[model samples]
Target: MNAFWNRWRKQLAWESVPAGTVEGRADRDPAVGPALTDELERVLTPVMRPCAGIALAGAAESPIHSFLTGHPYLPAGTTWPEGAAGPQIFVGQINFAEVASVGALPGFPRTGLLQWFVDADDTYGLTFDRSAGTAGFSTRWYADPSTAAGSPQPDAPTPTDTVDDLPMEFVGPTALQFRHSISIPDWSGLPAQHRSDPIWERLAAALGERRADPEFVYEEYVRGGSSLLDQLRTASKVGGYPSFTQDDPRGTGSYPAADSGQAELIIELDSIDVGGWGDSGVAHLFGDPAALATGGLTSIRYHWDCL
Candidate 1:
């Protein structure tokens, strides 16, 4: 068995919360007490957003905490081949609705296209809300830096690891793609938030068009780059992760503003084999690496939508 998978298998059992907790938990184990429920709900409510609801199209299991909470990969004194790259865990896809109401909009509204919960105040955490969907959606988590953690081998990561660190200040564009199934919620005959607004009607029309040409949508954005990969390569090298601006003389107007800061090499998820993913502990998923090199990987195809 792969050492990475070995570690994952050990955590298969369900981690439960008590009754009346944030998520639907066991009767005996309440996740949080009533004293904190109001505060918790307040924090959680903002994450839900006013115009949209998200469904967990799928998620790849994250590396062990010991693997990421400081270290990017397995910790020291672990066991695996010196150059073994384990199965890739790609987040499958996501579905968003305008209001989760009937006749409103079947998909995300374009008026306010900002990504939800990417703001600073949102914290990183996970919850399993059955009402939301099976394999509940996640919000506000930070990026994963994998190669920095010296593991499977005793070698320490090079300085390039830190360069990719995704603090709030760094920004870059991400071209992403992914595929998965969606279970549209049962919202029937609901009124729109505002009268004379056609958001819902527009959404219905879009769905009608999508029925003929069902396809995964792709997006290009001048947003944050992959800070996770930046740190990994930097940790493996010195100075910082390999830096090279898109060497296009046809400069200024083509891309976003010139951000000379270190950026993570691009990661292209070739294809998603499965979705609606979950586990008691260990899970396995794999994909081909579209880009993994010195200048930083590019040609990424994994794109997920957020309402």
Candidate 2:
């Protein structure tokens, strides 16, 4: 089996919070407890119903601890709001054998894995398709509805300003940002037959033979030049995942600016075939080269903060 497949299979078997148990657990928290419950009931419940037999896991003590604690793409020391309570995340996963379970759900494809994040505020949800290497995420934050009737809404920026021109400042104290990523190992050392995919052919031609050296590094895709979010948006439009537009309540329609000072690269790997391993599209390639040679993606880390 491909190393990535093995790793994901192991994760699927890891201990997880039982399905239908998150609501009761949220009740224990004092700060964000009620909000979590409300979010799950009002927002997530209906959204997740189609994913029959979906299992839930808590990430607080999972192997992804370091990522949740200190993500490289987020500001340093990023943590949940001080004294905030409730599970930081509830991972929803459909077993690999049951990939077809969610096929009837809008925007979901028939893939071996369908995982997503459900946060305390219930304001954000991210869906990751492991088989397709695609992700769809949406976040919404606003004042409590009871007091929002007459509140002044943030002015929608003039259409003239591109996303790159938007301010990088944090949106609010309750808003959270999350990312799902995958990494492709070094292709330079792979046999020539493994590099025959047309997409690889184009990538190699574009990089030129000399620049293809293992140490030369090709990060244009990582630096946001490849427009990862845009690809997600396109995939969403094509029913690959649910569509999230800026017009939705408090939704930004795209990832906020990277505060960790590293360029956020969400590369799209179309027609990717790994010698009977599988293929995917719109993959987010993490920017580390050392981890690539192993032939599996790093954890699909999920990070969020109150800011």
Candidate 3:
């Protein structure tokens, strides 16, 4: 990890997004409170969205502004290997959810919690259960590849057919405008295990370039009752009443909100010629380097949502 990533990682907290809970919604019925189902569904919906996105400039009816959703899951044994190499393992799916006491805003009688992107890099699988009392979260990260010759880890249960039933929705231009959050799981954090993986360097450099773009900005919002606040209030409320407590807000928000400071991160390879990687024109950094250093074919642009 680089300085920037290391610094942020230190501040990182691993909070489980309830798969199904009332507390995860921005607006909730204070009497009955938030339900676990509502919160979990919201998080899983976006996880189903493919990794790829396209921005075309235009109005709702304009076809140019449409986005092309990418594939949701890589086949169990599939790999993005650029050359003749072993297939990257398909671990498991990640789940997330959030909710608030009321609506997200001050004066509103609701607990507020913005949906910050969950740390998807954890090797453990997640299972969240929340009720009237407190929240109960469980995780089981798999270490060995699914195709490994030996038996799978005892802690890691053999994924069942039910895994396919898990909801993963596609967020097109329309979905982007809604109040939603996303969890990007399956990120390979170890360089030794993934040094040969070309996509890792390509993605890191791509995100770095995006972080460097002038138009690119990190955005967030304050969910006020009827009026918007200049300063963000980390409370959830509907009609000027806090529903959920700060220690336990109902709905959670992401740092780079879709329309706000968020810019779609795109990874494109010019070509994947078989023997073209060894001495590519540029030497790609595999292990770790400054995440801010500007180099490589990676590029970033602002307003891609409107593109």
Candidate 4:
């Protein structure tokens, strides 16, 4: 995810008030937050971020805290996470203690078992909320997994999102390995402040494009060595820039960004094998940097989109 967008990173000086609170609990809300000006892009440093690329190994060795799918570990005293419909389907989890041993992401939790589950029935657990906030999708975190001694299976029936006659069920109880890497933001995942920085034109001008169609300029940037976006190994990852098949789910009337710096990507679970979202897209959980730094898991939001 590293590339052209790194030419400049800016901080806008608009005096809009912040809308979403940084406190524990809940999803995203439209922010009356700051906006970046074109001038700021010229002086600010570039935004190159560090992230861990996740690869699905074979079946998990055990139920113990580790990055894996299908098999979920329920901590002692914790009830299964249920969404609006009924019981939620287990997605996967990350044992950050293991993550800390390998790579790192700024402000993310260093220890704990951060697990994910989504709503059953229709819509694949998405609430359809413009901001994609709310408990439509649930994320559970156990600061310590000492008591989580049992592996879990889907309490609800698996969804049948057969595409083109390709049958589907659950991804797998596959073990996962994390390799530390660097990532850069995409046109759609640029910071809120930078959205108004006329990047499309800047990119076009950089390529000396006489036509300058926003979409065409980007295609050229990726092909012209300005960005390795098309080659980034982030189909699955933690704490990296987001990759959306559709539009940037923030600030607009539809997809809203998390409060201020609170919406950084926590995890990106792309549809793999048997698991699919709509027409096969990625699911992302963004959390508040403040809470993440303190290892608190309640402050977060859920979002998924497809082409």
Task: Give Cα-based local distance difference scores for all models.
Answer: 0.20, 0.24, 0.20, 0.58
How well does each candidate superpose onto the true structure, as a TM-score? Answer: 0.17, 0.19, 0.16, 0.66
- Would you list the rank order by lDDT, best first? 4, 2, 1, 3
Q: Is candidate 2 or candidate 4 better by TM-score?
A: 4
Highest TM-score: give the candidate number.
4
Q: How far in Å is the alpha carbon of 5 misplaced in model 1?
A: 34
Q: How displaced is residue 286 in candidate 3, in Å?
A: 23
* Tens digits of per-residue lDDT for model 4, 199-271: 6665554334565665455434432244324334446678867777786565543334544676778888776
Which has the greatest lDDT? 4
What would the per-residue lDDT of candidate 3 be over residues 122-167, giving only the tens digit for each residue? 2112213332111111112122212233222333322222222211
Clashing pairs in 2: 185-292
lDDT of model 1 at position 299: 18
- List ranges where model 3 is wrong by over 4 Å: 1-222, 229-307
Q: Candidate order by TM-score, highest to lowest?
A: 4, 2, 1, 3
Distance (Å) between predicted and true CA of 288, model 3? Answer: 14
Worst 10 residues of 2 by lDDT: 268-277
lDDT of candidate 1 over 31-139, digit per residue (tens) = 2223223332232223221112122222213332211112223445533211112211212121111122211321222121111111111111112232211111211
Q: Model 4, poorest ten-residue lDDT window?
A: 8-17
TM-score of 1: 0.17
Of 1 and 4, the candidate ahead on TM-score is: 4
